[model samples]
Target: MARGSDRKRPDFYSRKAKASGRAARSVYKLEEMDQRWRILAKGQRVLDLGCSPGSWLQYAAEKIGPQGQAIGYDLKPVNATLPAHAEARIGDVYELDIEALGTFDVILSDMAPNTTGDRKTDAWRSAGLAENAMLIAQQSLKPGGHFIAKILEGGDVPELIKKLRQNYHKATQTRPKATRKESTEIFLVGLGKRH
Candidate 1:
């Protein structure tokens, strides 16, 4: 019989957070996606959802530079201060009007639903968040734009993937090196918006 003491531990995020000077190691996931997909560019407009702690915003601000613009939103206030070029709004993403923010070259969502320890329930909630973010992306993203968002391990992900495929030139799922091995979380990256 296996004992609880025998369970393996994963610390990829801790090590990455230390090395990268980020609030959380999840920033590397965006970095990896950007590297693989070339989603970010100089002078482009970017939006970040659930951007608390501002790690993704920090990375985006650095990548987009002064000529570019990066806007972030979250229900809770971000504890970290952002760069001069980056702006953050404290609000719910689902309620926000995407048109008011203008079109973006890239949209990134790292939103995670509050986990209840029930796998199925958690998955559904996470998927809902992803769905909302996708709708916002569709409304505000420029043609040929990019989107990256987090999703749980289960719940109608195939359908979501199919829809993404229809809207983007390519859509892929990636588990970044920065994510803990024990976590069921994954990222979906959509590139080259179709319309």
Candidate 2:
């Protein structure tokens, strides 16, 4: 038997995901953001970064429909079966060539640093990943596209937001209800990417 700390507890979202045959509970986060912000649309090409377990890609595939394509990349392999419109590859974000992959209508990143237990270190690392995602979005997103990236609250976040504001028509941040209570992660949404 597992100890109290070692035991896994399924929350309401997790149970819903299992019932709906979704990859993971993280799908709901993207759902809420998309619903509230009108991010994903049918026939839009999407690029998903750090898409391990592929919950976001699954959600994107449904939103974008068969006419659209959702491509995902992550350090770990995704074992789930993806929709015909979606595909995932194992790769590091830092090494990816955004230009070679071509442009996208939407770019999403759920990357987080491997936690070190120290909040500051973790947040800083998350900031770095978020920055990289922003760079990819800037380079690869078509005009009037959208970008969403997850970043832990850290000192560097304001600087990152400043850059987002300069590059996108509208830049905002949100903490989705699906996020864990203790998690410091917040998502930065950049709507209407400027050329």
Candidate 3:
């Protein structure tokens, strides 16, 4: 059998991210989705949940430009040096201080549970994280705001999408081209939150 490290060698996206000075390969996932959907607009306020390593924050900052704001929160501190318009803080999503953070025009969550090699258990945990991100979006997103969250594919995902559709003007899911072929991760895009 091939060695584990060899099996996981850097691919196109990984090399591209390195060349472009991005913090992680996951940045391409957000880039593809944002390009497709126009999720980030200049001068919009954005919140990035579970924004550790800060690649998403970096992308958001660039898209939003100098006039916009991008605030990120995660359990771990972001060590990356982001742009002036973007800032990341260490905090648990479950105990996020929404009032202090104020509302946002866009919310993004790329949070995922630590995998245990069991599909069902991991999916359940990912669903829970997505649900929590949805709740935060409902509360903090401005009327007609947008939300993007990552969730593993499994039984619980449909119900989560149902809730999103009920609350947003449009709800859909997509797997970005950057996603690994072996990965079950997909993104839920919720646009135009209702008043």
Candidate number achieving the greatest TM-score relative to the actual structure: 2
Q: Give per-residue CA lDDT, model 2, range 3-110, as digits (tens).
A: 121114788877888999988888889999999999999999999998988789999999999999999999988887898999999899999977789999999999
The models' CA-based lDDT, in order, is 0.83, 0.87, 0.87
Candidate 1: pairs in clash: none
Q: Which stretches of model 3 miss by more than 4 angstroms?
A: 1-8
lDDT over C-alpha atoms for residue 147 of model 1: 94
- CA shift at 97, candidate 3, in angstroms? 1.7
Query: TM-score: which is higher, 1 or 3?
Result: 3
Q: Which lDDT tens digits does candidate 3 get at residues 1-195?
A: 001211256999879888989887788899999988889999999999888788899999999999999999888888888988899998889998778889999999998777778889888888888999999998899999999999889938788889989999999999998888877888999999987
Q: Which ten residues in a row have the lowest lDDT in candidate 2?
A: 1-10
Query: What is candidate 3's CA lDDT for residue 32?
Result: 94
lDDT of 2 at 7: 17
Q: Give lDDT tens digits, candidate 1, residues 61-129.
A: 999999999999988777676778899889888789777899999999988877787889888988998
Score residue 62 of candidate 1 by CA lDDT.
92
How far is each candidate from the true structure, as Cα RMSD in Å? 4.7, 3.3, 3.4
State the TM-score for model 1: 0.91
Ranking by TM-score: 2, 3, 1
